[model samples]
Target: MKKHLTFLILLILTAATGYGQSATSDADSKIVTFRFQPGKDMFVLKGNETELTRLYSLVDEYHGRITAGELPIRVDGYCASRATEKANLHTAYLRANRVKSELITQKGLKEGDFVTANYATAYNGDKDVVVVTLRIPVKKETAVVKEEPKTETRTETKPEPQPTVKEQPAAPVTEPVTETVPETPAPVRPYHFAVRTNVLYDAMLLPTLGVEWRINTDLGVKLDGSLAWWGGEHGKTMKVWLLNPEVRWYLLHDKRFYAGVSGSYGEYNIYKYMVGNILSKDTGYQGSLWSAGLTVGYQLYLSRSFSVDFNLGLGYVRSEYDSFGMTNGVRVYKDRDKTKNFWGPTQVGINLIWTIGGHK
Candidate 1:
């Protein structure tokens, strides 16, 4: 019985020692945590003493020691459980890369200092947090500045008048005023939603608005709506409304270039065509138009919040209209239900897009 009790006591002691060592190690370092919003890669750092801010302060304080030798930094990223495992994993990867980018580009830390892991699937804690564990303590240096310098500065007297030994101070020994240039911030990645307007329609007095929703990394849907309802001088009437919906696939690695399949429907009444900003003739047509097309476009991200797109489409177009002509300032309908079919140039647009939500 005594032998068994002794073994149990030794086992307890060993367990306790192991836990104590872990506690001490954890106590020696601080674990800072930064949180992300849903579908965002950037962390929140606005509040007082936020984890991200604290991490920056810590890095700033220990920068000298960090650059002198190897500084171990571990960044673990996570996402919420709302998305699929693959989506969560992708978000986690972006979050970790974002932190590493800011640390290297903004804070002047070296990339080799980072040890990164994405734990969106494995993490069970706060789903929106990225935990940063720095292996060094805040007090990387023990010598306090006040302990050795204030009294010595007080004891030193002003310099006595000295004779000039040379005619000029040599340029080599007296270093030039070398200003440290700041590093440029990394470009923001586009994501989520966007609003756009087509200039081609606007020139014809038809105001248009388009909305795009990014469903995933590569696929998206866009809808464009246009309206022009106005009466002109000399009985020239222009009234139309159009809706175009498209599904797009971003094939390029930059996510700027895309291909889309589009369908359109419109109702229009044109007494005179609005071409070259002029109403041309007295002949008019009232029509319902339908089109199905394949569009190919390339997008250029001009800024974080804006992009320019150029696209052209070719497909089948069918229009059913009633031909009419004005007689002595009176309407005269000559024929009805005249149908026309065209197989080319269904869509053309130069769109200016504004991105919404946070950059992904």
Candidate 2:
């Protein structure tokens, strides 16, 4: 058993050594290395230990990122981590060099400039990768001077004196001329005329006739008359007549249409006769009647010089008799008291008109 254990131990040790050598050889052949930082103005060539040490020192002082002077730095490109054992130093260096070239050429920066850089780490499989960034500075320029402009001075010239001539006496001033114009006569407008027939709805009242004349478009005058005949108990027949005059005011004054109201006083006359009887003879009575009222109506134009008018009115009526007398061979008895008559709750009536004049 001891002999077998010794042989096995020797075999295991040889195999382990061979495996280790193979692993080391493969790593050396397949993997490459490089150094970068987040901020840098220049790139170090791959496998250049001297440049790598310089970059590392700069990166360490700036703490993985730096902005020295006016330059800006940042890390870019693909990477796994900073601690990558199998990093592609060649590709990393190429990328860094491109960044530096871009800053110098495209960004208008000087070559070999020391600029702040930023650094980062990434991992690819089991490899750590490092990146560097750098910013270029911008320079300011001074402005150029402008020359002052020269101005020219101008000289003034005086006018020459004119020769004097002997003056003749001035002619007498002429009077201003005036023009004469003919005056135009004013236009003439025709007058308006209206007539109305009014009959009370109640049986005791009489029908009335009214006429109106417009003195002007805004003012007018009215005249009215009424007549009635009545037969009562004891074979008595009565006749009555009333006349009224009024002044009117037009409320609206449009050319073709108008409306107005009027105030008027009425005069009435009555004649009455009674048949004969045994105790009293045929008797007669005569009186003057009075009435007062307001009227309102409108006028409509049928032509330039003619128009139609309509009106309605309400008023009170009263009759007074001086004395009573007998007639037609009848005996009569006269009372000492005089007779007075008053009638009306209201009076309403309308008028139709035919205007003759007053044209606008």
| Highest-scoring model, TM-score | 1
The prediction achieving the highest lDDT against the true structure is 1
- Give per-residue CA lDDT, model 1, range 239-334, as digits (tens): 899999999998754567888899899998888757413533657888899999999999865555777989988899999998788787777998
Off by over 4 Å in 1: 1-189, 273-280, 358-360
lDDT for 281 (candidate 2)? 47
RMSD of each: 17.5, 47.5
Report the error of model 1 at residue 215, Å: 0.4
Q: Worst lDDT window (10 residues) for model 2? A: 270-279
* Candidate 1 similarity to native, TM-score: 0.49
Candidate 2 ranges beyond 4 A from true positions = 1-190, 195-210, 228-236, 253-286, 300-310, 314-318, 322-347
Candidate 1: pairs in clash: none
Cα lDDT of model 2 by residue, 1-360, tens digit = 999999999999999999997665542211123444433323344544654455444433432223223333443444434344235444454455554443332222333343322223344432323344333222234354544444444444646544444445445555686853322222233356765555341234566777777776567777777666666654455566666677777653233334333333333222343211222343455555566666666655443334455555566666555444545534253543355644442234444445564332
